[model samples]
Target: MLLMTSIIITISTIILLKNKKSDLLDLKSEIKSISWPDKKEVNQSMLTVTLIIISASLIIWLIDSTLTFLISKII
Candidate 1:
């Protein structure tokens, strides 16, 4: 079983490398050309996202709590 699995994996890898060599190279070059964000920019974006998430969560919680309270009072 192990030998058969290894053989299958080897055949798949060979086919992939042969057929996708150009695609892989293109991807590598594209990755290299990407302008990654700097630490300050990333940090600022992260902070903004976190604040938005927290605000949304608080709003949802408030709405849920109000609904629950109203429903309980009715019951």
Candidate 2:
């Protein structure tokens, strides 16, 4: 079942990609129209994202440990 589903998805994606020449052209045009961020802004954004991810991971670890401790005590 999983193999069949994957084959069907692959075939459909191939068909869609083959049929999307005009859409791809439009997408290329739209991408060209975009004002991309400067190097310094990109660096700052990347740093912020890294810090946020680290902070979130620490928070999740703390919560998981606290929950595990409480559940152990209750049991």
Candidate 3:
């Protein structure tokens, strides 16, 4: 779900950029006018979020599989 939402947002952003809808009212040039955050900060934040999600998912999967295996063995 998170991946899907990210993809959707990315695609939408791309479309908006292509159509020049993201341009500011007073900005004359697209490249110079656009305000972008620090690349390092954005990358670090994305890395942290990705790691958290992956770890949580792995933990959940492990717990689910272990329970399933134990139940099958008992039956």
Best by TM-score: 1
* Tens digits of lDDT, candidate 1, 1-75: 999999999999999998799888899999999999999999999999999999999999999999999999999
Kindly report which residue stretches of model 1 are placed more than 4 angstroms away from their true locations once superposed.
Answer: 1-18
What is candidate 2's TM-score against the reference?
A: 0.57
Ranking by TM-score: 1, 2, 3
Q: Write the per-residue lDDT of candidate 2 for residues 1-75, one digit (tens) a residue.
A: 999999999999999998798789999999999998999999999999999999999999999999999999999
Each model's TM-score? 0.71, 0.57, 0.50
Candidate 1: lDDT over CA atoms? 0.97
- Clash pairs detected, candidate 1: none
C-alpha lDDT (0 to 100) for residue 63 of candidate 1: 100
Report residue 50 deviation for candidate 2 (angstroms).
0.6
RMSD of 1: 5.6
- Candidate 2 global Cα RMSD: 10.7
lDDT of each: 0.97, 0.97, 0.88
Deviating ranges (above 4 Å) for candidate 2: 1-29
